[model samples]
Target: MSSFEIYGGKKLKGELTVQGAKNEALQVLCAPLLTAEKVTISNIPDIVDVNKLIDLLQTMGVKIEKVERGTYVFQAKEIDLSYLETEDFKKRAGSLRGSIMIVGPLLARFGKGFIPKPGGDKIGRRRLDTHFDGFALLGAKFNYDAGEHFYSIEAKKLKGTYIHLDEASVTGTANIIMAAVLAEGTTTFYNAACEPYIQQLCKMLNSMGAKISGISSNLLTIEGVKELGGCYHRILPDMIEIGSFIGLAAMTQSEITIKDVSWENLGVIPNTFKRLGIKLERRGDDIFVPAQDSYEIDTFIDGSILTIYDAPWPGFTPDLLSIILVVATQAKGSVLIHQKMFESRLFFTDKLIDMGAQIILCDPHRATVIGLGRQHKLRGIQMTSPDIRAGVSLLIAALSAEGKSVIHNIEQIDRGYQDIDIRLRNIGADIRRIN
Candidate 1:
């Protein structure tokens, strides 16, 4: 395992360009499986999770060509369906959470899909019921092997129908849309996830001859097509990374410019930072976060404490709540972070408490942070990264803390952020990766 040895209390400068959306890449990379024609995807992030998915595609015999650093052409012309039955496929697919998405396209084109229990961050119970339930609603017969911990679904032909999702799950909605695109009738999907990533997937499917409406709304209507063709698609910049940079700037008193952030797609992210009294400005499509000694947390209008919680899209993203919670630790006031979607995500706050932050882990789902206002600097210590988001959060904290910090299990951070230590180093951060 590798670790990051960070020399803290350093200011970062220079501009950083955000990478392509990791979540969108996972969804669109699977879209190529629905067609035999060439599907070109641009601005793909060179991150571990995305690369794993690409490797999985290559193993399935998808013709993949690297057009450039962040562009690739994929043609699923001669897929090795029999490979799915191999032990190698099980080990590979079971380790990746994004592998669950490929099942939809396989079922849509080949009438059958099989996946082992998918693995991802142990943040909380991320149930697969939504994905399989949506598949079952589309006329697929679902089966499970409890002893083997495997899931399989098959269907002669899928017929579209109304689906009111139990929750607005992003991946679940993407999977169902992929399945319904080639179904016999129109699928009216209500309470769907309308995040930018989802909208991008729908738009990409539409470009491929699938009829889809409601681009940015909860109600989506997809008319099943006989077959889908290929098209060119460019992914949006990762909002999570952009948000992380913003928090890093505030915590470390760094002036950083994030370039080409796709401003319009960053719903409520900028305003949420502003709510924390962090000064940032929009320069064209870029975000400029100025260096600050201390930022103040905003309270509710009725004089109550500021409570930031996660909800469906257009609200604050749960992914960034870890960053927000970490940023709040050094702010001028107190704020409550409510991680509603995941129960165990806030558990990482214990590490921050060790770093000298005043934090109250109210429960598994909530944390209250009383900012120190820079009166006392956080002293770095040895820590372990729990998940992708939390790893980055702890990295940001270490960068703003005093003395040396060793962060173990940096592989978790690499899963989401590409060359994070290198990027931070380029911006004048004293971070080194030790193998």
Candidate 2:
């Protein structure tokens, strides 16, 4: 087991470059299965999830080579689809939510796909029903056995049709889009997810000869093509990492600049940070956060105590709520945090509560935070990371606290953020990784 020991109350002041989008990179790397040519992806984060996916792809007979540290050349010219049924594949596939994404490409290329139950953060019950529903709309039949926990889908030829998703689930939308790209006819998806990650995936697919329109709207129209060609795609900068950096800067009273933020693609992120009374200056494509004496929570228009809620695209993301909640502890005033998407995501606030913050747990999905507003500092303590975002949130809290703090289960953080300790340390954060 590894842990991070942080001597707190040091402001983070330096310029840091953000990594590529983990979510988008995962889909792009897997999208190569749609073609039998060489596909290259750049700006891929060197994180656990990406490494695991690379391992899974290599095991499936796809030729993968690291052209550079963050660049990969994938040649699926000789992919063996039969490996999809192997126990080895199933074991690795079951460890990631992104693994289920390959089902679409595999079904498109081989007319069949088998995937085990996918795993990710155990925040709530994530169902594959929406994914299968998309495939079903594309003329795929799904069979699952309770004991097996595996899904076998078969369709001789996918024929695209109009699909209105029951909900705007990101992965669900991506899965359907992947399946529909090679279908026999036109496919129109309404109420689709239009997050930047989704848009990037669509753009990459389109670059490979797939036709997709309405990139920034909840409605998508795709004209199915018989075959897709291999293409090179660069993953977008990680917005979640940018948001985390903003939160870290605010909490630590740090004056830091985030390089290569892709400011235009960060829809609603700047405004969302503004809601916390955190100010950011734009320097070209970079975000500069000034040293703050204190951060204040903004109230609603009616002058009532406010609440930051998570929703689908065009709304705040649930993943960043953990960082927002931690930053709120040092901000002035009170705010309610409603995590509607994931039930267990906000439960990690118990650790913050133990650190002398004023928080009321409404239930599994809601919490009310009354900030101390820099009048007090959180005392150092030991903690165990429960999940990915929460682990980073704790790290930020520890960085701003008094004395020393120790955090365990850093592997969860490593699964998403690449060299988090080294990067933060470079930015003057007094954190050390102990293995």
Go through the candidates in order and give each one's C-alpha lDDT: 0.95, 0.90
lDDT tens per residue, model 1, 1-435: 999999999999999999999999999999999999999999999999999999999999999999999999999999999998889999999999999999999999999988999998999999999999998899999999999899999999999999999999999999999999999998999999999999999999999999999889999998999999999999999999999999999999999999999999999999999999999999999999988878999999998999999999989999999999999988999999999999999999999999999999999999999999989889999999999999999999999999999999999999999888888999999999998
Which segments of model 1 are wrong by more than 4 Å? none
Give the Å shift of residue 55 in candidate 2: 0.8
1-435 per-residue lDDT for model 2 (tens digits): 999999999877898899999888778888998998889999999999889999888988899989999999898787777788889888999998789888889898889988999887778878888889999989999999789799999999999899999999998888889999999989999999999999999999999999999998999999999999988899999999999999999999989999999999998888888889998999999999999898678888899998888999988888899998999999999989999998899888999988878889999998998889888889889999988999999999999999999999998899899999999999898889897
The residue pairs in collision within model 1 are: none
Taking all chains together, the TM-score of candidate 2 against the true structure is 0.99
Per the 3 Å backbone cut-off, how many clashing residue pairs does candidate 1 have? 0
Worst 10 residues of 1 by lDDT: 418-427
